[model samples]
Target chain A: MNDLPHGLLTPQILVELDVLERNIERVARTVSAKGLALRPHAKTHKMHEIAGRQLEAGAVGLTVATIGEALTFALHGVGDLFVAYPLWISDAQAKRIRELLSYVKLSLGTDSIAAVQQLARQLADKKDKLGLMIEIDSGHHRSGVLPDEALDVARAAREAGLNVIGIFTFPGHSYAPGKPQEVTDQEQHALGEAARLLRADGFELKRISGGSTPTAELADNSLLTEVRPGVYVFGDAQQFELGRCQWENIALSVASTVISRHEGDAQNPRRIVLDAGSKILGSDRPGWATGFGRILENPDARISAISEHHATVLWPEGQPLPAYGEQLRVIPNHVCVAVNLVDQVSVVRDGEVIEHWDVAARGLNF
Target chain B: MNDLPHGLLTPQILVELDVLERNIERVARTVSAKGLALRPHAKTHKMHEIAGRQLEAGAVGLTVATIGEALTFALHGVGDLFVAYPLWISDAQAKRIRELLSYVKLSLGTDSIAAVQQLARQLADKKDKLGLMIEIDSGHHRSGVLPDEALDVARAAREAGLNVIGIFTFPGHSYAPGKPQEVTDQEQHALGEAARLLRADGFELKRISGGSTPTAELADNSLLTEVRPGVYVFGDAQQFELGRCQWENIALSVASTVISRHEGDAQNPRRIVLDAGSKILGSDRPGWATGFGRILENPDARISAISEHHATVLWPEGQPLPAYGEQLRVIPNHVCVAVNLVDQVSVVRDGEVIEHWDVAARGLNF
Candidate 1:
């Protein structure tokens, strides 16, 4: 552990190479054994190194949330990409998309006719070569058209000369505690119905993409051809609380130094201030997300409160508090946002830093 | 407004150059009128252009939260800087600080005897030349020693051959709704007591720094020799709701395109989704904060829900909803987090793109 970055900086993202590789192997094995294509979402780690590892582990393609993300992976030589977003592309972006298409096979998600038609117009001359998926609204009522309405978008894209690649849905509701099984059932039903409806509409629904790290394992291989999971490679506090992964399975953790130790009062005796705060750990506490995050050194020590540059962890009654300047590994509430907050992450193996990787796709929301 | 970036990616940060100038001028004028030295916090905009403007407007120096942030500004010719947070400096960072001090009049924050002694040892030969400020716990209760305990840390620094330059604090509690006045009063008391204690202890304390955007206006120039305010330069939803500023004062907003819309099923009557999600707008909602943020086009519309890549906003019944692909300006709950999420911001004047300013000090947490 002494090999870990010390006296360098506080609140720096540190990915254990051995653990990260194990996480990638574990997910790839499960995905491959189930005979389903693994399109690991690059939006989690957002590093070319991690994306390359996934590709090496037999991922058919990489999944992204934005054109910028897709562009980053494509530029880094990740050939096949899926922009799993109902994008509102500008003319300039459409041109950029074409530029990306010239280098790799690109797939896009469409939930509305306007988006399908717009994409068709953008892909005009080469529309027939482009891949499109009709995104179906599963239990997660964020985006995507309803299952019954998937055919309208599929047919519209086909009419516009784009290849309609079946349907896809994100069972994001699975994030809540113990809701994975229930949300997975909802996802299976939604995608199954959308594929059936598209087939009945005289369309050959070839591909069905089911996404959501929490619901990925419960995905039926027969109904869902592929599963796109981003956070599985990270395993955050939310995932740990959801029983989706164990603490030992969390591959991503932040190295933070204890900056101040305030023995509050008799009522609250063990409160220590950490350098990791909202700016680094990220302010992503869902009502159910125990605390800001769990202190890996002592899970019972919860980050009771957080400000922009300080995290106050109050240890339950009798546990020993870390001394000022002591380092602690913190598992953030949501690894994705926390990863996005840093410019680069130090890759370590058995306490020794192997190398540093740039969070290439970070802040690439555009 | 038509000349503004259109058909571009959604969830991009847009800064109205005219409004930005007005905000800077407003804060500089306020601080100047009070005869207090203004050292605008660069952690807000984190851009060289804005820092330059503040310096041009008579700002004595720049205040940064991290050594990296200070270094960036210093490399850009920003000579005088202060790292206001209680930093945990490592051996490597101590070396970096020396490099910074070579070009800039740098000041470091210390709240513990250990930190002061460590810093003194690191700067052993020229320890007395290094500027150090004992951070006093005004009312935030995050970091800093109590006013009464400041002497112990001060004597430790002086004994270690270091110069103790007065004290500093952040009235962070003022961030709560309707608590600005009370927090400001607390700050005055804390700083006033610390100064008196230090003077009686036979210490010549000169630089008494104070910070807090919400409480900056209420700061007493007689006690606080310098004031640092960051978020005031770009008002946010929190500020607007706290009556600190008005809607017209919000200089920064996310230009997000309407991605999805749900026409009620009796539950949610007029709900629409924007591409700007937590990854773009940032998740920093205080309990009293109305919503994630407010839509500038429709202030009544509240982003009641948000995911990583989508913000679900519900408008008041019967209010017009933006069409899919239409753009809306969103004022984030906290502008600092939102600005930190993006790499570059679109600078517009008269609704036309003038230049792009890199969030230069972004992700410089270390």
Candidate 2:
């Protein structure tokens, strides 16, 4: 309990180092025991310090969502990198990719035949090896080539003199409650089929990667050589709702204060407004989420509405409510997006301050 | 033109000095011509540099949504400040409030009896001078005391020794297309009824404030003495959809390059992909917005989807599409939120680089 005064946690993200270490250890152990490589996605915790911990915990490498994110990690000495996003390689990006291949091993994802041809043409002069992963559309209809089209894409990449290493898919459908098991099963089946098809076409399928936080536990690592799961290290409202993790297991939270209280009817008070709003706790409410966010200490309270700077929460029944100016902890709907919204996060241990880490990779969306 | 290389706009926000000057002059002229006190909300452009511009444009004071924002502006020498949101006052905040009152004229809003009582008790020593604005629910329905409950809260504040300055409301419903006139009409009616009710109870209603970007143009300044309108300085996708301004009038945009292009199909030969996504351009979609966002220079193109790091766009028919590595400008859906995501914005004029201004108040949401 450092008496650093309240409100010093302005735009702050409090992370319990103990809980974070536990999560990292658990995920790494689970994946390693099952003989699968753990390529923890850097999108969840963008800090190099956290990435170093993951690597120390036996993660084979790190996965990122964009070239910019990969470069951010690489600059901090992260060598083996896999950009999981289906990147559209331009001339400038191709040059950057060639340069990156010189320092570290790079695996890029592609979902289009045109993209595969473009990458091959751009890297014709490069002698360094670059891995290519063909993205398969398992269930999420956002982006990815259909499983039936995987072989054609793989053949095209091979003909273009690019290394067709493996298949990858994001089982984003596993995010919903009670759906993780089924979604994971579907994802495993999709990856297995895609892998077999590539092998039948005389292409070497070196890696088969699939998993999200909700489906990571249920993933069939028997066939997958590597598992990439982000957001599992910092459980959020989404993980809590999916029954993947408990509130106590949550590692990240926004420390906010009750700036105002509205006492309408004693029996059914209207709402308890907090200083933490959409701006602090990102306004990302998945379809099944009960509210914009949840109060860590006050479980029964739900944030009903959020403006740019005000979060209106409805209090629970038969509970002692907080008065104006009281401090509260908030667990956002999506921890990854919420953490990205802030400039810095406080690394806390047993309610005491440890150190402050700047979100160096924040706002690197492009 | 500055002849700067492509992708040289280091900071995201490009604030053209000449265009901003014209926008400020226009808004000030409109307020003066309509006989209303202009208190521009600083939440849109958090930079004190821009706030100073608004003050130089004849703004009576500045309106912020949070105490943190108020403190930030106060540090930058902004004297008169109005925390427009109905805040919850705490002990820690009370001390800050007292310190702020010594330097600037401070006015805060309250929509509930409990909040009013808390604020009154907190300001017991300085209640004689601190101004209080009763937030009236004027069709927005987010947070504000109902028109009927305004007098009760006002009575509580007065009894507790706080000075009741006036009432205020936000006509957020005016953001609809071609509905500004109707929304402002409702706003004026609500202000009139709330003012009359407070006056009947022997409370002096010194100021009646209302107006947002959409309703500002149609606001009837007869009843209200002051207006608070943010987002007028930088036109966004919402303003474009509401027919308030043309695409060319948009002062802010995200500069990105075509990192990938798919020319496989002639019918949709030009599928341009950008590096900017939800993190750069906010994921906010107004009900009437056609797509996630619009492409600058190419109005026919629409941003089809946004993943964490990729922006997929479908190019228009019969147009010369940008090749890979060609830079393009994107006008985001919501300029205010997008600006908050970055640390700095580039100030440009006539395609020439002017300067980079820090978003000093970016994360001051708390």
Candidate 3:
């Protein structure tokens, strides 16, 4: 552990190569064993290095949240990409998407007739080059239409001369405690129903993508042709608390230092301040989440509050508080958002930093 | 408004130059009228263009949250910079800080004896060149020491041959509902008591910094020599909801397009998905916040849920839902985090793109 340089900056993301590789291999192995394809979401790491590793581990392609992210990985030499979002493309973006199709197989999600028709009009002659996935609402009612409503979007795509590849659903509700298995069942049911309806309408469904980090392992291979689990590679505090992964399975952590310490008083509790906070770790706390984040060195130490650059940690009772300037690894509550906050991440193996990977698609939200 | 380019990409930040200038000038006038120095925290905008405007508006200096942010502005010709955080500097950072002091009037915050002693040891002969401000906890209870405890930290700085120039506190509790005036009073009391104690110990203090966006206007200018207000430059949903600023006072908003529309059913309510989400808007909803964020055009519309690249918005009861591909301006819950999420912001005047300002100090959270 001493191999991590002293005087190294705080709030720097360190990706443990050994653990990261193991995470990638394990996910790939599980998917392959079930005869299901894996298209690991690149939105979590957003680095070509991690995407390359996933592809090397037999992933069929990369899954991204936006067309910009797809273009990034495509430019990085990834030949196949799926933009798993209901993209509302502008004419300029359509031109870029057309250019991207020249070098890669591109697909995007759609849940509305207006969006599909708009995409068809924007793509014009290039419509055939891109594929479309009908998004279905599977308990997580953020985006996506109901299962029965998938046929309307698919029909719209067909009428507009666009290719309807398959359907997908995000089991996001699994993020809550004791919901993984239940949400997985909902995901499978939604995708299965959408596929049944689309197939009955003589649509050839080649892909059925589903799964978030929490429900990926529990995904039914018969229903989901591929899994797009983004956060499984990093395994954040949310996943750890949800029992989706063990603490040892976490591969990425922010190296932070205790900047100030305060002893308990009547009004104030015993606490220490860490350099890592919302700006780096990200402010993403689900109502069910225990706190803002977790201290990897001591999980019992709770992050009571987080400001832009200050994470106030309540030290575990009876445990010696970290001295001022003492380093601690902080696991963000949501790894995806935290990773997006940084431009690059340090890749380490057995405490030695092997290389640094640029978060090539860091803010490609468009 | 149609001057905004057609087919512009979604999830893009638009900084309205007219509103931005007015906001800056208003704050400058307020501080000038109160006879208080205005050191606008550049952490909110992080762009040199905005900092230049603030300085031109008669700000005493630029306040940053980290040393890296200070270095960015310092390199950009911002001669006066204060890193208002209890920075526990490493040896390499100390060297960089010393190099910065050669050109910029650099001051940092400290709340611990160990941190002051460490800085003294790191700087060695260069210790006299740097100034320290003892941080006091008015009510934020994050990083600062208590009002009375500020003297112990100051004594340590005085004993270590470091310059203790003044004291500072962040009345962050003002962010809550109905708490701005109360927090401002607490801030004044804490700063007054800390200054009194430090002055009683025969230490001459020059600076008494206090204020956050919520409490900056309510600050007692008689007690605080200078006030640091960051989020006022580009008002966000938080400030607007807290009744600190009017809706039209907001200077920055994300341009987003409706991607999907869902009519209400027995199971789900009517909603539409936007291209902007947590990845661009940032996930920062205070417990007292109304919702995740707000649609600038329709304040009644609520961003019910936000994923990586999808914002699920609940359209108002009587208001017509935006058509698929229709664009709208979205105000993020926290403008500071939202600005940091993007690499560059498009400056607009009368809807025409004026310039693209780089977020030079973005993600420089050391």
User: What are the per-model DockQ values?
Assistant: 0.66, 0.31, 0.83
Which window of 10 residues has the lowest lDDT sum in candidate 2 chain A? A1-10
> What are the lDDT figures for the candidates, one per model?
0.85, 0.79, 0.88
What is every candidate's alpha-carbon RMSD to the true fold?
1.8, 4.2, 1.3
lDDT of 1 by residue, B311-350 (tens): 9898778867778789888889999889989889988777
How well is each residue in B1-366 modelled by candidate 2, as lDDT tens digits? 122235442214466567677788898999988999999999898998889999998999999987778988998999999998777676666877887887888899888778888887777878877899989867766567767788888888878888899999988768778788888887888788889999999988878999998878677678989999888888887888888866656777777766556543442334677767777777766658877778776778888766556577888777766865566777778787788888888888767776889988887766
Q: Clashing residue pairs in candidate 2, if any?
A: A259-B88, A260-B88, B13-B345, B13-B346, B14-B346, B15-B347
Q: How well is candidate 2 docked (DockQ)?
A: 0.31
Model 2 error, position B359 (Å): 1.5
State which candidate has the highest lDDT. Answer: 3
User: How big an interface RMSD has model 3?
Assistant: 1.0
Q: In model 1 chain B, which range of ten residues has the least summed lDDT?
A: B1-10
Q: Could you tell me which residue pairs clash in candidate 1? A: A90-B7
Model 3, B1-366: lDDT tens digits are: 324445679889999999999999999999889989999999899999999999999999999988888888998899988889998878767878888888888899999999999999988888777889999999788889997888998988888899999999988888989999889989989899999999999999999999899988877678899999999998999999999999989888999988888778778888988889888999999988878899888888988888878888999887778888888888999999999999999988877887999999889988
RMSD (CA, angstroms), candidate 2: 4.2
TM-score of 1: 0.97
Candidate rank order under DockQ = 3, 1, 2
Candidate 3 chain B, run of 10 with poorest lDDT: B1-10
